[model samples]
Target: MLFLNRADAGRRLATRLTGFAGPDTIVLGLPRGGVPVALEVARALGAPLDVVVVRKLGSPLNPEYALGAIGAGGVRVVDTDAMRALGVTAREIDSTEVRERAELERRTVRFRGTRAELDLAGKTAIVVDDGIATGSTARAACLIVREMGASRIVLAVPVAPRDWIARIGGAADEFVCLETPAHFFAVGQWYADFTQTTDEEVSAALATTRVT
Candidate 1:
């Protein structure tokens, strides 16, 4: 099914996640695109919403390739196999991590402002993304949430390829992907209008979910 947009996709995805609504549940969206989709889920579930800022440690020569990712609180996940195959050095990884971590911190502040991060200890942490592509960043998010002491981790997205389920399923306690197309090319292809979600939209969505 083609989604009208992320908001529409999110509302549809939220229906599949109705059973997870509770005080112990916290919905965390991967920023830039995932926040709008997550807002709908949070609203439908009556759960608190937050952004989990993570930066892709792109390959030095090919910026599109993610060799690793860095999350909040210094959480890092690396693909050693990819690094080794690409002849990436430890020094290169460290330098790339430093650069990405700096941007991650900046985005965390920009998106969340004064809102203290929700303590995920013993809570059901639901990580939401608009869609999954390479699944590296989403895998990194699940690991980071697990490190934060979450009792359970659920990875939810509007759409993904079947390969992603096989790829990152181990990281999440439960995977709640709405549509897993066999011929998936890109996340945007499944949407009618997959425009880039702006920073203002993300910040506004977060404000609507802020604890009063």
Candidate 2:
């Protein structure tokens, strides 16, 4: 199934997650694309919304191909198989992490400002993203949230490959994926309006969460 947009997809996802709504539940979106989708979920569930800023550690040669991801609290998830196959050395991986971690911090400040990060301790943290490709970012996100003391981690997304759902499912207490098409090539292919989500849009989405 194709989504009209991230907002539409989010509304549908929220319906499936209604049972989890309450004071104990918090929705964390992986910006900047996930923020738009997550805003709808946060509103529907009447839960607080937060951004989980994670940066993809892309291959030096092919920047689009993520070797892994880096998230808050210095959590990092690397695909050892991908690294070995591509002959990526430890030094290269470290260099990439340094760059991505810097960006991750910048985004955290840009999106959150003076507001301290939401305390996930003893709370059910539902992590949302626009979609999953290799699942590296989502995996990293789950680990990061868990490190922050979340009692449970739920990874939610609009679309993902069936294989990816299986691969990353173990990382969270629950994995909720709206679309798991076998022919999935990229997340954008399943969206009618797959425009790039901007920082300004992300901030606007977060603003709605504050007043909700």
Candidate 3:
């Protein structure tokens, strides 16, 4: 299935998640692209919208290779087995995490500004994203939401690879994906207009939701 844009994709995804609509359900969008989609979901569900900032901790030797990810509230997820196999030292991991944490903080500020983070305690945290590729970021988001005391975690996305559940199923209590094409290559390919989401757009979306 092809989506006109993130907003279109979000509206479609929200239909499947109507059962989750309630006061206790909170919707969190990954920064930038995910925010627009999540804004629609939050509107449909009448749930508070927030940003879940996370950063992938790339390997020192191979920057493209993620060792794991870090999120807000001191949440960190590391692949110990991969670290050992790659011979990544503790110091290297620490250094990488430090850098990623800095970016995560910067993004959190950019998206939420002075607004205090919404409490997820005993709530159903619905983590929304534009799409899933490697699923590392989404996994980290689930881990972070759990650390924040969410009673239930649902990882939702507009589109993903056919085998996405195998890669990220363990991270959350439930999953909702609109499309999982077997021939998926990248998230952009399924969208008719996959423009990069701007920081201003993200901030505006959040502000609109907060006011309404």
Which prediction has more favorable TM-score, 1 or 3?
Answer: 3
lDDT of 2 by residue, 98-144 (tens): 88888888988898877778888999999999999888778778877
My TM-score estimates for the predictions, one after another, are 0.91, 0.86, 0.94
**Candidate 1 lDDT, 1-212, residue by residue in tens:** 99999999999999999999999999999988999999999999999898888787888998668787777877788889999999999899999888888888999999988888888899999999999988977987887888778999999999999888777857899999989998999999999999999999999998999664
Clashing pairs in 3: none
What is the overall TM-score of model 3 with all chains considered together? 0.94
**Residue-level error in angstroms, candidate 1, position 57:** 2.5
Tell me the whole-model lDDT of each prediction, alpha carbons only: 0.89, 0.86, 0.89
The alpha-carbon deviation from the true structure for residue 116 of candidate 3, after best TM-score superposition, in angstroms, is 1.1
Candidate 3 lDDT, 27-90, residue by residue in tens: 9999889999999999999898988888887889887677788877788888889899999998
Candidate 2 global lDDT:
0.86
